[model samples]
Target: MVTALIVLYFISAITNSKKIVILSGVVFSFLLYPETFFIICAISLLVKILSTYVIIKDLYIALTVLVLILLKNTFFSTASGYQLVGVSFALFQVCYYIKDNISCGDLISKLSFFPQLYCGPIVKPSSFDRLKKINIKSLALYHLIFAIGLFFKIYVAYVTHKIFLEDNSLLNSVFWLAYMYSDYLSWSLMGIGIAGLAGFKMPMSFRAPFFCRNVSQFYSRWNITVFKWCNDFFKVSGSKKYRKYKAYINIIVSVSVLSLWHGLTFNFLSFGIFNITYFLIQNKIKKYRKILLISQILFYFLVGYTFNGIIPNYIFPTISYKYGILFIVSLVTLFLFDFFFYRKVKKIISISPPLVIAVSLIFVTISFFVRHIDGQFYYAQF
Candidate 1:
């Protein structure tokens, strides 16, 4: 990965041709994801054809994208594992391309940009518009960002995942929540960092979700980009009638699509039901605000972690002092680290270059020594 980044960086510097840079992106994407890339190209071609002759372009494109999502979820995972790499994100981008009425060239670039495409911030057509390539000045900062992501996944999420493998636990539910957030956030931040190095400022995916008051708020903070995409795609501004019921329809549509986007399983469908049901319950009660607040926190975690089977009788078993301390650190790292550093990213990195360098090196060293997991990113499968 490091070698590829360096080569791409130098190649970008050496080439005066935009075509060369885009060609490299194509190769990088196809190399990691041959099967998915083929599908993306096919979709791009379809979008081009759709743009040419379709009279009702927007409606047809929307229907077509939803069908593409359904087909992708049904067929690809069964046929081949590698084909699933970035199908969800690429399909969504295809949706945006058609809606935004961009060229096939733009759609191809968005789909084949491996960093964001792999595990995405799900960028739009203007994501790379008017942007210059190569920002040597921000290279250190991007490196630190990537290192933080590595630490989040390879070290923090890895350590927290031990809670699952073993029975020992101070808080099974808590650590499971930590594990999910860290694992996903790590990929997100790494995507941001690499995308930055590749010269595009990506939107954030996680933003200190612990402060959220409800499941809706939690997800808005947790996967802000996808949440935003859901909202954007479903928005209705047609007539006053469409606008009047927009919020309710948006919530239902976003929640349902977000759930099933992970794949249409009993668990995911149930997750959507659970979310909407909980929303109704929250609306019914206006008092005991503290209790509802706490309940909302528990509700988010329970549905997220325990939806695979019947809910167990959780007793919150205790763990050894060693694991207990690690658990606490994982929570703090996943929840609070962004709150302190991310909002003020430029200021934090600018405070002391040496400190930033030290932190990046520390994470890199720890990643080298950490026992590696043998699987793709937990979110990538969906």
Candidate 2:
């Protein structure tokens, strides 16, 4: 698939055949997964019809309902596995394309872009408009970005597998949540990295989420492109009488929408609700920010357990003292890395390419030793 896309990219670059490139690319994606393609086409057609026939404001509301139905069925597993996997992102892209009335060439390129085909940072059509230009300049930098992201993903997979193998306990749960966050971070980075290599300016999907001191900040930093899309598409502007509560209402509505975008299962639904409740509580007691932050971390740990359906026997299992200490140290270290070095890590790699390569190779080697048959990313299925 990668090879085919590379050939297509170069062909387009050399000949500048925009329509043919986009059409052929779309055809290739359809051929690769006909089932998913058909589903995407259905939703795309629905969105297109509504957008063309209805008023802009009404279309937004109707489109939201249409998408909600599709999500509830597919994401909640009411649809078959073949119908569900890979539909979430494709649905979002197609809707964006139809609403924006994007050019044929750009629409095709945005949807069929292989780097984010399976999962995405959920780029809006407007966002991809500026990325229409393609070039092969500075290819080495792209490779480095891809390598670093892939290394992080593989390493997280390795550690996650190891965590599951250990005894189930609060310590393991903490590590598990850490792994889950890292897994998501890695996935976003990988998408950005690969898209960059292809000369497509993928949107920023993550920032210093770990460093965020509040729930609102956390959501804004995490899965950044998704939030950006939500802000645009799901902007909840209440009437004058309800203006003071607009922020809270927007927070809940937006997060609920984004959470459903994650998946329509109860687990994801609860995750959104939990955050909403916490956000409200924090607003009422602004002085307890530190306590709220600590609580937020624990809430995430509970989410991991709830999402995975693997409850520990006790809140604090009677595990070895050494292992318990190890878990705390590991969790703190992971958080610290992201908090302090989130921005610097990328800069370090750009400045010291050889060192980055060496470290990536080492991480890959370690991954081989610790590897287990990990499943696709939690979000990738969507």
TM values, all candidates = 0.83, 0.74
**Candidate 2 lDDT over residue span 1-382, tens digit each:** 3334334534443444445554555676677767666666666566667657865674475366546645654445533554455566766665566667654445545666544666577776554433554433333344445455555555544455456557687655566666666666666665555445444556766776767666777778877766666666666667788889877876786677666665566776676777788788777766787787786666666656645546676566555666556555555655665665556655665676665545544654454456454456656555
Candidate 1: lDDT of 329? 83
lDDT of 1 by residue, 1-382 (tens): 3334334444543452445655786788788668878878887888788667765545455556666666666566533553467777887777667646677776787787765676677787777653475444376676687788777776788777777556433345566667777887777776666556556666788788887666666667867877887776666677986876665666677777777676566776787888777766765563768877977877755664434434434566555778878877887776568677767777876777667756665666555556355345666665
* All candidates: CA RMSD (Å): 3.9, 5.2
Off by over 4 Å in 1: 1-25, 57-60, 78-83, 99-106, 130-138, 165-173, 237-246, 286-288, 318-321, 354-374
Q: After superposition, how far is residue 55 of candidate 1 from its true place, in Å?
A: 3.6
Cα deviation in Å at residue 287, candidate 1?
A: 5.3
lDDT for residue 240 in candidate 1, whole number 0-100? 82
